[model samples]
Target chain A: MRKIKMIVEYDGSNYHGFQSQKNAHTIQDTIENALYKLTGHKIPIISAGRTDRGVHALGQVIAFETEAKIPSDKFYLALNSVLPEDIRILNSKEVETDFHPRFQAIKKQYSYYIYTKDSGKTFLRKFAWCNSEPLNIDDMIKACKQFEGRHNFLSFCSSGSSVKTFERTIEVCQLQQKNAYLKFDIKANGFLYNMARIIVGTVVDVGRGKIKVNDINDIIKARDRNAAGSTAPPQGLYLMYVEY
Target chain B: MRKIKMIVEYDGSNYHGFQSQKNAHTIQDTIENALYKLTGHKIPIISAGRTDRGVHALGQVIAFETEAKIPSDKFYLALNSVLPEDIRILNSKEVETDFHPRFQAIKKQYSYYIYTKDSGKTFLRKFAWCNSEPLNIDDMIKACKQFEGRHNFLSFCSSGSSVKTFERTIEVCQLQQKNAYLKFDIKANGFLYNMARIIVGTVVDVGRGKIKVNDINDIIKARDRNAAGSTAPPQGLYLMYVEY
Candidate 1:
């Protein structure tokens, strides 16, 4: 069996999540069903990360074993022909038999977009979070800087995640303003469940002057979910890249 | 009674269209219902343009008469509170008694976004037209320039529109590209039904070398619907702004 690695893109609005569950539609189930149609085998695929419901991914990575005779370049086109318009295979390549997309991933990048206008634009309503309140970009940036290092990010992550360790390295964290949108670009070695959304929520509170910038360290030290800001909505989070 | 003009935004994926039709969910009908809930009377709103099904808008302008005593600034917040998350009133102000959103509009700007990547990102799937092909952007720019001046766009218009004259002045037409997305920003005194989409489709053909740059002028001169390219999908077209 050859290991096939693929770059996948999906609109997660109508999906239960990335994981396959009984009686629930999910991105994984959709692609796996399409693969079953193509290869005539139900091959379970592994993803770099599991996205929650209503969360989206632009370049999500996945891998699966297949005995089909098709070439690597033909995998993307063949799978895409059977996939729905909302889900697509961006690229495909062959990988080592021992390679795992999730375990071997060195870093992952995610972007959270916020339409900061007094009202949201029509097309972006389903994708970006709309907040009419004035957000202090400077304060948000200052708070974001505090998160740019290795720390036990227990407070920033939601409870009930299967992760055993809260320690993770955040290599880069940035807040950028473009036109009427504020985008958060974050890169980390690993992330816990709903970590990025909780980070954004905490920073948003800082921008709204509800929390002090230095409070981020204390929250991280507290290792408590309730110590952080409320979890930001799922529509704003996007998995941008997974580096192997 | 005071005439109030509103700049509205809505996701049209779930609506029939802009105009109110029997037994169908239209953007106009939804907003009117919200208005009726706020005031105890029915008020008909006139829109600057009527967008087709699955089309979205950012700066669509509508005007209605109301005898309510709410402050003008409060109109934005009050209406937003009652409106669904998919539709929002971005701005509201009192206009001249003679001001008509449809009749007195000086110019309108519309943009068509095309996702020309091998595959589109998940979050943008609903808002952008997904076309999988590498096209020459320079050729599109050259052909798009021919549409910048006053011209009779009869050929680009859809059939069944009852406008007497097809002559319209185009103040600006620009084709801009970023990464995998290409946007055509076109401003004109008025657009024929499906004119923007047809124009975008025709330009995309030019970009793909399916049509010559000079063929745009010839097509316009033909003044026949068959002379234009296929009507692009409605989701890609956005009513950007209107000046009254």
Candidate 2:
């Protein structure tokens, strides 16, 4: 058996999520179905990140073992011919038999987009969170600095995650504004369920003056889900890349 | 009755076109239906440009006469509440009874986007034309200047147009490349049927070395539709704005 690793990109607007479920359209299921058609076998794949519904990805990583004879480098082109237009294999290559996508990942980067225009841009509605109200970007920028370090992110995690600990190290957190759009990018070793969204929501609340910038440290220390702001919608979040 | 003018934006992926037709989903038909719901009257709208199917618009101008008692500025909010998410009213105001959206327009701007990346970016698939091959942008940029000033654009105009003359002045024609995306922007006093798209297609041909830069003048002088390159797809075209 040969192990193959591929970088995947997908628009998650029409998908339930990355994981498979009964009678639901999902990115993983669609790709696996396409693989079945290509290799004539059921192939179970593992991914670096199991993104939430409506969350997009630019460089999602996945791996699978197969006995098919197709060359490793040509897998992307062969799979793209069969997969739907919304999902694509950007790159594919043979990997060591023991290589695992999730357990061997060192860093992951995510970006959340916000459209701050008074009027909506129809083309961007599916990909961005639209907020007409003015946001204090300086306050949001200041609050981003607070998230860069090791911390117990229990306040930022949602319920139902089976994790060993709430502690994670954030290497980078920054906000950038271009025209009427704001992008919040964060890089971390790992993320808990809805951690990125909750952090973005809290930062947005700070931008809206609902939460003070000086209180971000306290909120993280509180270690309670209720202490954080509401979770931002999934449509605005993007899993940018994963490094291993 | 009061005449209302509005700046409209729409993603045309779901619509047949901007014009209304029997049993066809269109931008005009959808907006008119929303108008009927708001005013309890069947009202027709006049647009500055009737975009082709799959063509988007960021600042399309439209006007309609209404007997509804709602404030003119508030009409946008009222109509937006009933319209689908793909269509939006960017701005609205009361206009003179004699004002017309198309007849009185002074200038219009349109943009065509091309994605020159080897792999498609999932988020931009619906908005840009993806071409993996390398393009000679310097050649394309040189050809843009040839389109300026008054000229008989018969070679660029497609069939099925009812215009009296093909002579139009292109005020601005330029190409800007940011990373792997190329934007061809053109401003003109008027356009013939499929004129902008045909011009872009011809320019792209120039970029591919399929046509020489020096031969542009001869192609325009030919004044034959067959003399120009193929028509670019409607999905890459955008009616950026119409000026009064």
Best model number under TM-score:
2
Stretches off by above 4 angstroms in model 2 are: none
**Model 2 agreement with the true structure over B1-244: per-residue lDDT tens digits:** 8999999999998899999999999999999999999889999999999999999999999999988999999999999999999999987999999999999999999999988886546777778787767779999999999999999999999999999899999999999998888999999999999999999999999998999999999999999999999898888889999998
**Least accurate stretch of 10 residues (summed lDDT) in model 2 chain B?**
B118-127
Worst 10 residues of 1 chain B by lDDT: B117-126
> TM-score of candidate 2 restricted to chain B?
0.98
- Per-model TM-score on C-alpha atoms: 0.90, 0.98
Taken over the whole model, the C-alpha lDDT of each candidate is 0.89, 0.93
The DockQ of each candidate is: 0.57, 0.64
Please, what are the lDDT tens digits per residue for candidate 1 over residues A25-114?
999999999999999999999999999998989989999999998898789999999999888888899999999999999999999999
* Residue-by-residue lDDT tens digits, candidate 1, B86-181: 888887999888888888889999988888765555556668898868788998999889998888899998888999999999998889988778
TM-score of 2: 0.98
How well does candidate 2 score on lDDT at residue A215? 96
Q: What clash pairs does model 2 have?
A: none
